[model samples]
Target: MIDIDLHMHSTCSDGLLEPEDLVNAAGRAGLGVIALCDHDSIAGVARAMAAGRARGVEVLTGVELSVAWQNWRDVHLLGYGIDLASPELLRCLATFAERRANRNREIVAAVNRRLDHEGRQPLDPDDVTALAGGVMGRPHIARALMARAYVASMEEAFDRYLVPCDVPKTYWPMEEAIAAIRRAGGAAVLAHPTSISTDFTVLERLVGGLAAIGLDGVEVYNSMASEAEAAFLQGLTRRHRLVTTAGSDFHGIDPGDTMGKGRGGIRFSGALLPPLYARIAERQEPL
Candidate 1:
């Protein structure tokens, strides 16, 4: 049975379920371990951990930071075993939230302007915030677009008005984020490398560069990763001497389905946990 999922989201960010409800669902899904790696937010982690304890699910301290490298779009870094009280993390997250809110407002204004030009009523930005509840995101905007029938699908919505440029550019440099994660007593793992691109040759160079700096692990098992992709990632892990990790990247939007099940029923073994724990411990050890 698939019991371990190290990545997911909750309403604390752009997810559809609240922290408690997400934990409950994970429990019902037979997930033994999970992490609430909400986008650039840790507000849900404490609640998730508490609920995890109640449901006998181990919730790790995880946060997925939005980062950008030179010409690379949306390079997310996942920090595991971070100290929840780290002031550095808290401060950065506050700025991220503000920037994200501003970005969402910009996109809404742009969309509304276009709608007004077409003689349609403008969409209230507040409606999008109501959907997100916390950190605003493109998914929230997409939902709002869908509700208004402005677009038939999420893809068309992005293609029409909510393009990436509409979003604010409040992001950390990849190196800076990795260092911050380390300072917070966490192991930094590159989240979903396969999502970067399909070109294995380019990915190899990217992984090498990241590893040369301080990347400790790669997400080898994820819904987006194919079997061949997973094997390629495993080879990268060995070559880079990095830890291996897996995650379903559950966002709680897909209701009625249990958590921890990655794309195409990909299952993770309990055996994968120790290496990550070991990496965390190693990071915590005094040099």
Candidate 2:
């Protein structure tokens, strides 16, 4: 009854812990296998893998790609077992990173305008960037706001400034993202499909359409999915012939969110890994 968590984050993205500390935490949490699925960056993977080796935790190379599908502008695709050196994958991630940086600048500008209206000092984009270990994210900006005493907490930063001042995120087209994962020799699994839509009918159609376009698996057991929703997703994967996986989506910022187990005891059995591994291997096979 080994436990595995297929999704988590580190300072490489917006997560609170650094890559090495994240792995150490996972090792302490008793997660046998874990994936450091940083948002749009794999810069921390090597460090995390090294820490994993030392901690006796099996770290899988993973990334959470932000992608757009249809009218849904913020869907995430998790790529597992990816080739860190894949040119196509690297190119796309680099492009997204630049876009994210630009967006952060825009967000700062907007935040500055609000601050000006309120007669407060403006946030410096450089300061926000300095807070991020890897790719700049909203969480970094929120920390900047906190440091400036503009917001009391991360939530207030988002609700008052970060969310309101957000520039639209540029996203890879869903098809292109899935193709990039395949090119990188990885399995592209939709992370927390329930976030796209909790309505079963719409969610089913979305999953079906993605499956038709090369989605390798669906994350059925996710922290975001309710028990009933997870059950439905399990059946949905069977209906679409897609492999199923689970993740805690841990970022280590929120309270009560465990590593191997999510909030409310959402746990994944190691049994989920075999099919996912098989799918990743199938993608890696010469075509």
Candidate 3:
């Protein structure tokens, strides 16, 4: 059986751990397989895969595409088994990276101005780039704040400053993201649907639209989903004939904690892979 996690991040994105460190940590946590679903980037996949191989863990190529749905913002689309070299896929991701950098600059400037009002040294966007270059996310900014001791903790940084600019002004249209995943020969799963909206009526419509747009799966077991929410999403998964996916959404929150474990140290089992693999394989078949 595979002890697996379908989502995670590394220094290549918002996460603090380097790609190799994340994979190595997964191995230590007894994970047989894991996915590097970094936000809008596959830059870490190759290094993680190499580390996974060395550690006897199978690394699945994954990317978390950010999109918007309805009033909801920052909806994540997890693309599994993607072709990192897909030109179209790269083109779309490049746009996201550019926007993310701009957002980072804005967040840093805002936080610094606030710090100045508080009579303190301002932080530079370079501090975030020093952490991770390609994609500068809110978490990266939060870390920089923490580094300066501007905030006692990440939670404080977020609540006091970072939360104001969390969402990107622009995101890939949901349809375009799904289309990119398809073109990359991967399965697109809606990530943590309930995190943004818990109303079944809302999710029903959301899932329906996503299904119609070539989304292949629903993230039924996620760290943020309550038991009741998971059950609700599981019902949607069944209703839409979608594959169920799980992940820890790890961002180096606790170095001692395992990357694959969720809120209560719960990790996904390998039992999920057979069906998911089947679906990806079926999709790749000439239709």
lDDT of each: 0.85, 0.90, 0.84
Clash pairs for candidate 1: none
Could you tell me the lDDT of residue 242 within candidate 1?
Answer: 95
Better of 2 and 3 by TM-score: 2
Which regions of candidate 3 deviate over 4 angstroms? 165-168, 254-258, 263-265
Q: Write the per-residue lDDT of candidate 3 for residues 51-87, one digit (tens) a residue.
A: 9889999999999987976676778899998887889
Q: Score every model by TM-score.
A: 0.90, 0.97, 0.93
Best by TM-score: 2
Residue pairs clashing in model 3 are 2-270
Put the candidates in lDDT order, highest first. Answer: 2, 1, 3
Q: Can you write out model 1's per-residue Cα lDDT over 1-287, one digit (the tens) per residue?
A: 44788989998787878888988988887889898999989988999999989999999999999898778868889999999999998888888888877877888888888888889888888888888877888778888888989888767878887883375567889998998899899999998898998699988998899999899999898888888989999999999999999988888554533467656787777778888899899878988
How well does candidate 1 match the true structure, expressed as C-alpha RMSD?
2.4
- The TM-score between candidate 1 and the true structure equals 0.90
Error of 1 at 66 (Å): 1.8
